[model samples]
Target: MCPEPSTSGVSPPVDAVTGIEAETDHENDAFSDYASDVSDTTSTTSSVRAYVYENGRRYHSYRPGQYLLPNDETEQDRLDMTHHVFSLTLNGDLCKTELDNPQSILDIGTGTGIWAMDIGDAYPSAEVIGTDLSPIQSEWVPPNVQFEVDDATLDWTFPENKFDFIHARTLAGAIQDWPDLVGKCYTHCKAGGQVEISEGRANFFCDDDTLDKSSKTWQWLAEFRKLSEPLGFDIAPRLPDILKAAGFEDVQLTQKHVPLGTWPKDPKLREIGRIFRVQFLEMAIEAYSLALFTRFGNWTSEEVQVLLAMVRTELKSNKIHLYTYTYLNDLKRKAESNDSNDHHSPEKRQNTLTSEAGNDDPGDEITNNLSQDSQFLAASTSGEETLPNLKNPLVSTPSKFLTDFQGRRRFLGPSSTWAYSRHVMGLIRKYLGQHQPLEIPLNTDGTAFALEFPSTKQPGTTITMQDLPSRDYAIYLINTVKFHVCQTYHLFEEQSFMQGFSKLYSEGPQPLNAENKLWYVQYFIVMAFGKALLMRGSSEVNPYGSEYISRAMELLPDVNGLYQDPITSVEICCGLSLYLQSVDHRNTAYVYVSEYLQFYRVLHELICCSLVSPFA
Candidate 1:
């Protein structure tokens, strides 16, 4: 229960939303106000003050394992550094909202109270409140800013429909229930209040040949995800859907790329990269690992340190253009909106986990620099699309590949396809002759023209089927993608593809032979897509097939003569592009699209020179 507000002699701070003069006393009871708002069950007691120390690091005493990161001096410094990095990424803005004067704001998981204090300073008239499990905020803060010891997972008790804006950053691992947290924010917010959530995932990526699929850095991050997912930590991909389920209207998601080192030629991005490297090497790696690896992974502190040391070395190298993906999901609550289903409906919540923060931008942001500024983009699922069921019988799937729900418009529904896919199919149809039907082959029988597989430049170092799904599972996945997902207007012909997959799966546990290298990547992507689309309710098709996608990507350049079968390259690119897009990997899909065009030009030249056959 909230302690009754005592009437004071001094003029009360005006309630910003209702324009009512609320009775209040701040001097004697500062923490309790923000504290009571977030946690109803927990009190302002000494138990929260209890601190735990392990592995030469510190963690919160209350709900000790709810959060993965430590709450210590080094961790404090990292928190502040993270705020600076986010500020830089957002071009010095405290947030993306345009509210000129927000009355009351809540910052969840406000480590060290840096963002709260900064936001308080930004809007001096507005009262700002920050909450965290640990009371580590600075003693001296702006008059309007207050630090509270509260847990977000608890029932919010301050008041319903109260705050003007709520902000939470990097809470991927802190809150166990993302939907529950957002639902609370939506409820406690005033009629038009807004919420912003910023989370970054360690999904490492590279455009060039520098970062390998087998790199330890990739392996280490993958390991962390594998372990942390059981605890419900991964965030970026599913946040948008979760927010919408909470009835947050006009939800928007933006993606920003942070390089591991100074690799970007753009001056602004280079600066971001330098600081980004410090963010990882200085404290992030250690702060991330000490608790996670030691406790859950059952590994000694020394082993974790040695692995981190090697990771640090790799991060420092300029050759590798390593980078990570960060996302911001911003939304607003409507005044008259009725609570849709139970904000925590189990079925709706289950559908959200597979949803990705899908970007509708065709690679323009990834390939170019708009003055090198990080831009906010509306997600593909941000708006609703409704179109009458198509009555035309002659309209083939290939003809509609380039369009969304409505062609050349922002009206993107389920039928929304990438521009690259449209162009690739158009070219394939043009060459094969408008009247001739397309035949997409799947077998590695080596019985057709442009079919003889080329030997690898270095066969010993070639990528083979080492880590993949079992034979039966692989067959099921291929069948799932049989009629579509071939390499040009690309798709897998059922019979031939089944024949190839049968032979490939016969190898049992042994690594695939050298002659099967091209077939290996093609088969790998087929299975990757198959499993990606076939998951009954898997949280992420991404993790299930990430290794498959990564290996096929590695084999793209240098290893296999992908140009031998131009349509094959198109098939890989188109299939992977769709699969990547499905997993909310829009930027990487864009790169594959660029690769699709690069090979399309090669195939165009081959046609002119009479060196290759189109339907071969």
Candidate 2:
């Protein structure tokens, strides 16, 4: 019943970004050789029984070619991330409709069954069913929850007008015949059942209109929009009308701005955008394109990939303020109008995902639902903020999200310096057995109660010459770090870091200036991550990684040991911060992050102004 990730075709797409790969075959390696016989009696309980593969991805086989995206593990993870992003958009509430002791819950197009499982766990008494064309859900689900492989577009065998709640999302590109689908939803949902459908408009929008109409990002989207028209992917704008046409009453239309990256200024919105960045950059860009372009547009996989790479680069560019609108068309907005008095309290409609984990604290202000993910996320923002003043989103955004440290606000961290100092004094008092502590905000990723120790003391050890890897191995590690780490966090200046690497690894240990020494420390820190990624199979303390980090720590001790070169100092600080975050030194990593944000923000502002400034 389980569909495994491809055993091959895992080639990295570096050249894809450059759009220079030679053309070849079109068959996808993931499932090209795998095929299933047509059983006289096909079970609706599993999709692995039958499969269709294309362009290095998998898709639903019920109506094999209808849906444009894949149904593999990669797509499943993106779906979960999408769910988390939206949950955050609603401020911890799963839906706008307050589920009143829901007895029956139905999640349509339940990609990974994450939402269905969470709902099942929350409403123990409710009977929950998640239906999709793929039966990839885990075998172990809540007793009340179950999954079925049913084609939503075809006749659903589910009892009509029986569900108390029905929900669907991210079904933009997969859907065909929108009205019939809504009619079926209305037909199946109980008389007073609440239906929530969220479909983001299939096109991107720039409030500032800075995105050129002729840009690849726009051109590609316009191509997909026109191509997918016959397939009926443009479902967001017509969803409300569809619900109304289906005889659904009290339809409420709520819209959310789904930013494409870390472009929003609001603390929560910035966090949301950050997660979307990863979701789009790593996989969604290709996942959303490969099928539509090749199957419909008759473009070769290589050509589509080339165009997709250009789009990826454009999406990641800093010149645009782009976002898409996701509309929530709920069928029960009028359910609570009878009593204008608010009835849903935090205690009553508490979000269940974090409730059991004890993560929900109203006093904490911001809630990160993604769990060790990005926020700015549902857990990890890029770990290190390139912008120094991340905490001041409103102020920084109006000033074009200043990256410069010049004239930055004094208070930049989650908590102010005065508050941090108070915590320090409180820790000392507590150590002496006499202390009355004031309420302090734990803003550093909520990693610590107080900054007691910088981190566990390290041995005064150094990575000896004998411990260093060969030149080729070192280059491999650096490249691995670049693809895996640098692409995500943007750790350091490419040319400068490469130059440093060349100098340090040259025939002679270049005369050790302060700059050289600091670069040596930074290089070691970067190399540690290379070892960490490769050592995933083993959880034991990696002696080599430990040794590299220890030697770096021995040289620098704290974040950015030297400040002579502010840019290099910020780089050191970011590298250290990411390492600390990886090793569960989150609070310490946060401190490093807070410091670097100030330094990096200014540097970023200077670069952007230099590039785009009219006077320049």
**Pairs of colliding residues, candidate 1:** 404-416, 486-490, 486-491, 487-570, 487-571
Clashes of each: 5, 18
RMSD (Å) per prediction: 24.8, 18.3
**Candidate 1 global TM-score:** 0.51
Q: In model 1, what lDDT does residue 306 have?
A: 88
What value does the lDDT take at residue 594 in candidate 1? 86
Candidate that scores best on TM-score: 1
Residue-level lDDT of model 2, residues 1-616, one tens digit each, is 0111122211211111111111123122221111100002225634544778888787777757667789775676567567767766665456657565668888988877878876765555578988877766654455578887767777678775578899998887667666667666766777677898888766655544446766777677667767876676756655655555445666766666666654454545555665666567666878888888888898899999888888766665444555655677777523323321122222222232123223212122222121121222122123133323223211112111112243221111121232434555666667888756556544444242221222453433334446565443455457557745774576777787777666555553554455566777778787777765433211222322555776666666443436445566667778878766655466767777786797667666766644432222
**Which 10 residues in a row give candidate 2 its minimum summed lDDT?**
31-40
Q: CA lDDT of 410 in candidate 1?
A: 23
Cα displacement (Å) at residue 126, model 2: 0.9
Can you tell me which runs of candidate 1 are displaced by over 4 Å? 1-38, 41-46, 213-215, 340-616
Candidate 2, residue 97: CA error in Å?
1.2
